[model samples]
Target: MQAISYWLKAYGESHQNPINQKIHKVAVPGIFLSVVGLIWSIPQLSLFGFSLNWVWVAAIPALVFYFWLSISVFILMLAYTLACIGFIWSMEILNWPVLPISMLLFGVLWIFQFVGHKIEGKKPSFFEDVQFLLIGPVWVFFKQ
Candidate 1:
């Protein structure tokens, strides 16, 4: 965990271009929505006699990674839960329309990140390491 934290911090600093910083901010909630929507999309992927929707399980690695790397466990969990609830509500109630809405949100957030990077005159971090993708949301947590 310590090693992961070091890497995350290093990655953030090394790739702290303007675009990444901006993207990290917007992408946090957008990615959260994406994850929740993903889990809720497969309504039958349940466990223990109830629908589990393995997508929700994404929180495990994400939560572990964030707290283990940089952000606090409290904030990470709270954000994850809120995102999950929003996703579930949208999917269960709005149905098919929710997916497009989530996608649009995700897309717009990503564009902002790129624009930030462009302003910074540096390439986006994901170009160097894919793990940076996971690191993006936690970066946003710190910003807040």
Candidate 2:
């Protein structure tokens, strides 16, 4: 964990562009909402008779992509995954609406991000690295 933190901090420093900051501002709430939506969507996933492990599955691409940029991002991704799991378990809510809910959260987060970037007077990190899109969620989640 310390190693991951060190790496993430280093990555944050190196990639501390205005764009990333703006993305973070919006991504935080977006991820929170997305988590809620995921909770809402999980019941349907369970109907398949095998529950899913989101960390190894859904979060892989995001984690791999973050590790490429910084260990901090990987750590953040880890935290985000754990948080999502906790949220779902605590709420005991699940259904098929999670897909659209996640999308809606993403869209809202994106809009907030754009607004943040506009305020920062910079472009989004995605302009430099598309993977930053994935990182934005973790960055936002950890900030809280």
Candidate 3:
């Protein structure tokens, strides 16, 4: 169980280049939102009067991961997760093509992310450990 600082520090190593940092400042959040959108596009289910979707189901483990790290991290990630969920919900209400849109945005953001890594001359830390995928939003959003 690495601490939040440990994960952030590790993730920061490959992000030292200013260009990479700037690209990540936007790409990370876009990637997060796009992922949530992709999950949100999944067919929803109902249980005991509550609607459940893949995004909602997935959020629990992710939130618990943050909670395991620190309370402040948990709170911040909870808020961020809810915000993304809300935005995805709005897209659903508006009849937006969330699936295709998320797929497109996800691809585009990854291109920027790979470019950032190329400029930094380091492979993305997620290559070392998949959990870095979860830490990325925390680093990009505020915890950095």
Top candidate on TM-score is 3
Q: Over all chains combined, what TM-score does candidate 1 have?
A: 0.69
Predicted candidate 3 versus true structure: per-residue lDDT over 1-144, tens digit per residue: 999889988999899999999999999999999999999988889889988798978999999999999999999999999999999889989999999999999999999999999999999999989999999999987635
Ten contiguous residues with the weakest lDDT in model 3:
135-144
Question: Scored by CA lDDT, what does every candidate get?
Answer: 0.64, 0.58, 0.93
The model with the greater lDDT, 1 or 3, is 3
Per-residue lDDT over 1-144 for candidate 2, one digit per residue giving the tens place of the 0 to 100 score: 224354335335434557657567657656655755564455434435787644345556656766775676667666766677566545445434456757777678768766766766667666765554554565455543
> lDDT at 2 for candidate 1?
49
* Model 1 poorest 10 in a row by lDDT: 1-10
Query: Which has the better TM-score: candidate 2, or candidate 3?
Result: 3
Residue-wise C-alpha lDDT for candidate 1, range 1-144, written one tens digit per residue: 445555557656645565566556666667667656655555556567786656647666766666665456446765766666665676678556656666777678767766777767777667877767766655566553
**Which sections of candidate 1 miss by over 4 Å?**
1-8, 14-23, 46-49, 94-96
TM-score of 3: 0.95
Task: Identify the runs in model 2 with alpha carbons over 4 angstroms from their true place.
Answer: 1-23, 32-55, 65-73, 89-97, 137-144
How many collisions per candidate? 6, 4, 0
